[model samples]
Target chain A: MAVQITTQEAVKKIRDKSSVMIGGFLGAAVPLKMIDEIATAGIKELTVISIGAGYRGGGVDIGKLVLNKQISKYVTSHVGTDPNLIKQIVNQEVELELSPMGTFVERIRAGGAGLGAVVTPVGMGTEVEEMAEKIIVDDKPYLLFKPIRADVAVIKAHRCDPLGNLQYKGMSNTSPVMATAADIVIVEVDEIVEVGAIACENIGTPGIFVDYIVKGHSYQERKNVYEELWIATNKL
Target chain B: MSRDYIAKRIAKEFRDGMYVNLGIGIPTESANYIPAGTEVFLQTENGGLMFGPKPERGESDPDLANAGAEPITMLPGGAVFDVATSFAMIRGGHIDMTVVGALEVDQAGSIASWKIPGKLLTGMGGAMDLLYGCKRVIVAMTHTDKHGNSKIRKRCTLPLTAAAVVDMIITDKAVFRVAEDGLYLEELAAAVTVAEIERLTEATIMNIGEWQESEMS
Candidate 1:
């Protein structure tokens, strides 16, 4: 069973420099409130791994984090649409470690599974391989990609029972495996109900994967409150 | 010389089997003359490759795109791959060449590939990776804007893509190679005179004497 916590408590639990995997690709089905909490906490040097979708978050989701100066480095797939990331990287304002989207997912999954490393042909003879270690297997050289792990996982869910069973409502998912790998799995949901209220089978991630549940605050009149969050966070 | 003339001249530097990443605008036009069957592979930072010709209307694949976020069809022998890996290829030093346009280039070969002084722009797409990754870089642009300010200057006053990665400069006025010695003039557009080209240039350019005419495919 998971404890029911307010959004602030959920945010408070995450320490500084903690690695967090925030869900959603291109902003769909993302955990806006939890992200807001993390941004507001003024956590320094936190590593955020996500698909760059500041545009769909009504702007890039992590761009606000970058703008707010909450995060120090990023392990992301794309930041093309995010103007702030572009400017920062161009200006050398932040440290960015970029990986391919598929490779990024594989790294998260491989980390959770306790795999030491995976061989990929994606970055061969390229700059990504410049950081790579080459190994010979059967007389052919292969690039060994390292495993990635997170300290905390901030995940979004459509519904969560008191037991912490979760249901994801969206087209696709990103960095879900980091939930199982991280030490603390904090879940933010649109709605929270009783245990067993959600069908046992429909839950995408079982309750065992979650450590805490924070319910999302809905403001009917002030739509897209997440956008206002950056303005507030930047003041901090 | 002009931007198109420079682009056509820069197209001559393409060598066989060179792994290349092209930037947007006039530099993207160099795809038209990739040595017919040079075995060159084009990478776009956004996702896919359109290494060959601009496909006919219906022949394009909506899913396959260039670094510029435009729809494209791959050249023959092209394969589909993930975007991150594509960039890894760029960042990993797998590319042999990068040909892109420049907003500004200083005498020392420092480049500005992103942001016009006052306007918000689309920004760099693999330009940083291409700048630092590829072994050879060629910039294609006119000698000056229609407004007549040098794109080639003493220093780049704009947001630079990467430090100093330029190996060659192909301007509408002439073809200049960035040698250890200096900017050496290799070829000239027929209409432009060597003395006129030298007067307009910002740096001490080497007139490697004259070379052949350029035909942009």
Candidate 2:
């Protein structure tokens, strides 16, 4: 059974220098309240694994961590969207390790499934091959990437039952896999319902993978957050 | 030639029922020009597939977004999944075509679009995987940089996204088909001359067929 916890309590589970997996693509499906709490807690030297840098501009979503200098290492597929994060990576302030987006997600899937590694030909003749071990099988060459497991995973979902069955409304992105690949999974959801409320078929993440649940902003509130940011950044 | 012209030309590559992935920047513009009455499903690495056009300002959904993180709408038959499944569709060669922006492309059909060494460090994102797995890979970019240096190069100076993966190159001034032998000029923008193209492009035009004049309107 997963216990309901406050966002502050959820952030307390993360420690300095911990390898943390943040589940989201850009700002969509991101755990904003939990990310804010983690930033306010001032945790430092984190090895943050995410799909990309935060939303397009700086100082939003996971970009807040970059502004706070909380991350020492970033394992991501892209950083071009966030200028602050790019500056950190360019200036040697944050060590950056990148994998092609497909390969990156496969590695996390492999971790969750208890696989040793994944081999693919996607990066055979590019700079990505330099970052991994090359193996040949039956005269065919492939790059092998090791699985990635994190100490804690922070994810967002649309709704959750009291027992922690998560249901996602739109793009789930990396949350489902991150929920399984971490030792402690903290999920932020917009609403909490009865244990039997979420149908089994609708459950995106089962309670077995979740450790704690934190209530997040409502749908309208979340929409307002992005709308305000978009207007402020002149993207609207 | 304008960016819209480049995108319009690239959009002709889409076949009915094709599942296409569009990379960020100019490649995203190709979606707006997808041929009328051609039902092509748009796939985004962020997890949505068969997504439609951008939503109106006040009608946007925070949860529904494209790979570029811009608000988007899903078609009637669209579906959403987790990131792992999304990439599986990409790496498993389920995507029919992909249009991407490039920093440089060489005579060998190799592309360099992800990095610029110490100056810029944007990671490859999904370009490498898309180029390697998609049935057809098309590059949509300007013919030259702002300094008038050709981006179609004899050899790319930047890091490679993938080698020998580009099937077609669509630029503001011309369209080139990448064959196993070499690059072949297949079309030219209106009012653009072969002499001008030869002077600007760094890569040798292996063969110039009876090239068609591209429609500007």
Candidate 3:
């Protein structure tokens, strides 16, 4: 059973200096309304865990937090798209911990699955090797990355039933894993349907993992939002 | 040679039925030049597989996007999954080849594309994993920087993306293959001479094989 809440109420659950996981890749599947609420709430010193920075050029979605100086630390795989975030990191305002995209997601999955750590050969001979502990098994070298768990996770989905069974339309990105790796999971969805509306096979995130649900903009509205931003940014 | 010419040359390396991942910038443009008869599936780290070309302006879907955050279309047989599964496909060695843009490439096939230390804060997105997992790693880039300094170096001064992972280098001027022994020159763009290459490239060319002129008019 999940409680339906407003975006304002959802942001209230996140405290300053909390470890938060935001699910999205660039800008595709972000919880925009919740992020907006968080930005408005002026939460500071957050440890934001995400796969990458928000859309190219910044000042959109998660980039809003960067502009607000809300995040104290960013745990992510890529930040090339957001110049604002880059500038902050360069100025020593935001601490950055980076890993390969694959390894970043795997660490989250490992956290959700209760694994100790993940051993990978992906960063064996690069700067990534300096970030993690190196281990040798059978004469082959691998890097050991610890699991990542967050205080709260905000994710976006296409639809959800009253019971909070989520169904994603396209590109689930990091939501599903982030949903499982958080203490409190707040999901923003386009629509809320009847209890049995979402078929079991179609459920992307089960109600067991979701704590709260917030109704967000519909598919068309989100499309228009991105279209406007893209046009403004000369990306369209 | 233009960036399109570098991408076109890189596209020639693809084989039919290959599952390829293209990095941002010029490597992403190589998708448009994939061979006509070839059946290549494009994988974006963002979670979509077998994605097609960019969507028309008004026809774009908010949920459908490439790794670069640009609107994209999925092919008829395409599928979408979560990020964990997407990276599993990458790290599991399911991707056949990956084409990525590089800032510098050393003679030992090591690449430095992710960071420029204190200057550029661009983090390594998935380049290290792609180089470590993909069956083949092809670097698509210009031969020199805007200042005419060679990017092909004896040693990369910047932080490396991965060491000894590049299988091929397709630049605006030449093509080189990395082997266990050393780097070998395989092809040259038209009107480009060996003397020019020697002056432009900083790394030692171990061997000059039979030079095949690139099909660039």
**Candidate with the greatest DockQ versus the true structure:** 3
Model 1 has how many clashing residue pairs? 20
lDDT string, candidate 1, B1-217, tens digits: 2555655665677778777777776777766756676766776654454355544544443234344333356677765444345656766687788888787886667787655644644424345556766778888887887687777776777766655668888877777777665677777678777667756876765443432122221
Clashing pairs in 2: none
How much DockQ does model 2 earn?
A: 0.76
lDDT of 2 by residue, B93-143 (tens): 999999998999998999999888878788888888899999999999999
Tell me the lDDT of model 2 at A86: 90
Tell me what TM-score chain B of candidate 1 gets against the true chain B: 0.84
Q: What TM-score would every model get versus the actual structure?
A: 0.52, 0.97, 0.97
In model 3, the runs with Cα more than 4 Å from the true position are B209-217
DockQ of 3: 0.78
Cα misplacement distance, residue A124 of candidate 1 (Å): 23
RMSD value for candidate 3? 2.4
Clashes of each: 20, 0, 0
Each model's DockQ?
0.04, 0.76, 0.78
Tens digits of per-residue lDDT for model 3 on B102-217?
Answer: 99998899999988866787889988888888999999899999999999999888989999999999999999998887788888898888778878999988864233233322
The most accurate candidate by lDDT is: 3
The digit string of per-residue lDDT tens for model 3 on A171-234 reads 9999999999999999999889998888899999999999999999988999999788767766
Q: In candidate 2 chain B, where is summed lDDT lowest over 10 consecutive residues?
A: B208-217
**How high a TM-score does candidate 3 get?**
0.97
